[model samples]
Each structure stands twice: as C-alpha cells, then as structure tokens.
Target: MKVLVIGANGQIGKKIVRLLSPTNFVRAMVRKAEQMPKLESLGGYPIIGDLEKDFSYAYDEIDAVIFAAGSGGHTGADKTIAVDQFGAIKAIETAKEYGVKRFVLISSLFAGEPEKGPKSLETYLEAKGRADDALINSGLEYTILRPTTLSDDDPTGKVSDVTAFGKSSVTRSDVAAFVAAVLPEEKTYKRIYTFANGDIPIKDYL
Candidate 1:
C-alpha cells in the first residue's frame, strides 16, 4: 500500500515512515526541504507539504494517510486550532476526496473530554478532540489512537488499552509500533482506542 504520512518529520510520524517504508510505499510529508534527506534515508519518498497551507497535492496516488501533525506545546491556542483542528479536518476532507482507503490519527488522552484535563491544556485537548470527531464523522475508513502522556523511553513492545488500565504514559516508539501494526488491520478500522505501556504484546493485543 502507498501511505501519505503527514508530519513525517515529527517523533511518531518519522517512526511510522520508517516502519512503513520497508514494505510499503511511503510519501513522507514534511514542512521543510531540509527534512527530506532524513526520510529518504528511511526509505520514504519525501515531499514538502505544510499543514498550515495548501497540502492537498501530497495525497496524489496515496492509498492511506496518517495525520500526525501538531502545533507543539510551545505554540499558542491559535496555532493549535489551526494545525491540530483545522489542519486535520482539511486532511480528512482531502483524503476522502482523493479516495484514500484509510486515515489514522494520533490524538491525545483527554481529547474527547478536554475539560477533564489540566486547565492549561484545555485548548490543546479541545483542538485534538475536534479533529478526532471530524475523522470519526468523515465517512472514511479510519482509526484513532488516543495515547496518554508520551515519553522518550524505549519501546517495550507491549501495551494496555486505556479503557481497561486507566490513564498512563507510553513511549513514543511503542506508539509508532502500534500504528504500524494496525495500518493494514481491518479489525482496527473505525475503532478508537486509548492505550499505554503494558504487558500485552502489540500484535497479540490487536
């Protein structure tokens, strides 16, 4: 399959590109031309596309999409709304328009219930929530993975569903592993799940 990985230079996004490139065609979309070499080294076909502007061209010949773009913590509410919310919504619409088979989103833990999260993060959480809702309602085959606080720790190759284990942090590598594992999984389509580090191997849990 050919996959368009949005925000492919970001942490989890880069990992997804690396994982997918070995067996699938990857269009690793990034904001800067300088980022292309890193993705190229990972076996991805890197392309320049900004979420804050016109990026619909990145969808060309893409079979699926992974919307991993973000405004980062340092950005203000406006950037959050623009990138996390509107940007994701636009990607969804474009994917649907382009006949993409699937769309996967990397969302936050409290995205669906922003008010329950820390007040300082309410805006960010709300933006993620809106984007998640847009994908759920976009009528395109989709998977939304809402993970808890992220850490830079190494992958454990195991995880637990948050619905059963409650909130907890997870390594970025493990999250990327999970996304790669589920990309071709029909069972995961149209499913939204929150997860964190745990004992169950990712494939077994799937």
Candidate 2:
C-alpha cells in the first residue's frame, strides 16, 4: 500500500514511518527540504510541503494519508487553528480530491470540552477537537485515534482493547502502532475510538 504521512518528522510520525517502511510505500511529507534526508534514510520518499499551504502535489499516487503533523508546544490561538485545525482539513480535502482510500488521524483526549484543566493546554485541544469533528463528518473512510498525554516511552506493541471514553495517557510509540495496525484493517474504518495504556486487554474492549 502507498501511504502519505504528514508531519513525518514528529515523534510519533517518525516511528510510524519506520514501522511501515518495510512493507508499504510511504511518502513522508515535511515542511522543509533538510528534513528529507532523515525520512529517506528510513526508506521513505520524502516530499517537501507545508500544511499551512496547498499540498495538492503530495497526494499523488497515495492510497492512504495520515495527518500526524501538529504545531509543537507553541501556544497561540492562531497557530493552533492554522496547524491543527486547518492543516488537517486541508489534508483531508486533498486526499479526497485525489481519491485516497483511507485517512488516519491522531487526535487528543478532552478535545471537545469547553472547560480546560488548570494546567491543560486549551487552544491545542480545542483545535484538535474541531479537526476531529470535521474528519468525522467528512464522508471519508477515516479512523480517529484520540490518545492522552503522549510520552516518549518505548512501545508496548500491545493495545488496550477497552474503550477509553475519558482522559488517559499513552506513549507516542503505541500511538504509532495503533495508526499502523488500523490502516490495513477494514474493521477500523469510519470509527472514532480513543486509547490509553492500562492493564486491560484490547480484546476485552474490542
């Protein structure tokens, strides 16, 4: 399968590229040309493009697209809307235009809530929520994976099958695993599910 991975240089994006490279043709999209070398090293075809701009060219000959890109740690309402919300919508539209088959979105927990935690990042979550909603209604075959508090820990290579409706935490590696696993499976299509690391078995939840 041919997969187009946006934000291929991000924490989880990089891991997804590594995991999918062996069997799938991956087009890694980045904002800068310099980042291409690292993605190419991972057996990905690095394409320079920006989420804040038009990416019609990046959608070429792609079977699936994953919007793993985000505006990192920077806080601002404008940046949040641009990268998180608009960027995702743009990618989805482009994918649809090119007749792409599947879309995998990495979203956040507590995305649609109006009340922000005392220490929670509000703008980012709000933007993610909006984007998630858009994708859900986009009439596309999509899978939305909402994970909480992303960490840099190693992958467990296991998923909690339990349905996580509320807030929780998980690692980037696990998130990438979920993205990778869901792509080739028809059972996950058009579903909106959330995940977290816990003692529960995935089979129990599924």
C-alpha RMSD values across all candidates? 1.7, 2.5
Model 2, residue 189: what's the lDDT? 89
Q: Among these predicted structures, which one has the highest lDDT? A: 1
Query: lDDT of all predictions, in order shown?
Result: 0.89, 0.82
Per-residue lDDT tens digits for candidate 1, residues 13-52, read: 9999888898999999999999999999999999999888
User: Which stretches of model 1 miss by more than 4 angstroms?
Assistant: 163-167
Clashes of each: 0, 2
Evaluate residue 142 in candidate 2 and report its C-alpha lDDT on the 0 to 100 scale.
94
Summed over model 2, clashes come to: 2
Candidate 2 — which residues are off by over 4 angstroms?
116-119, 161-168, 200-206
Give the clashing pairs for model 2: 161-202, 161-205
Clashing pairs in 1: none
lDDT for 56 (candidate 1): 91
Q: Score candidate 1 by lDDT.
A: 0.89
Candidate 1 vs. true structure, TM-score: 0.95
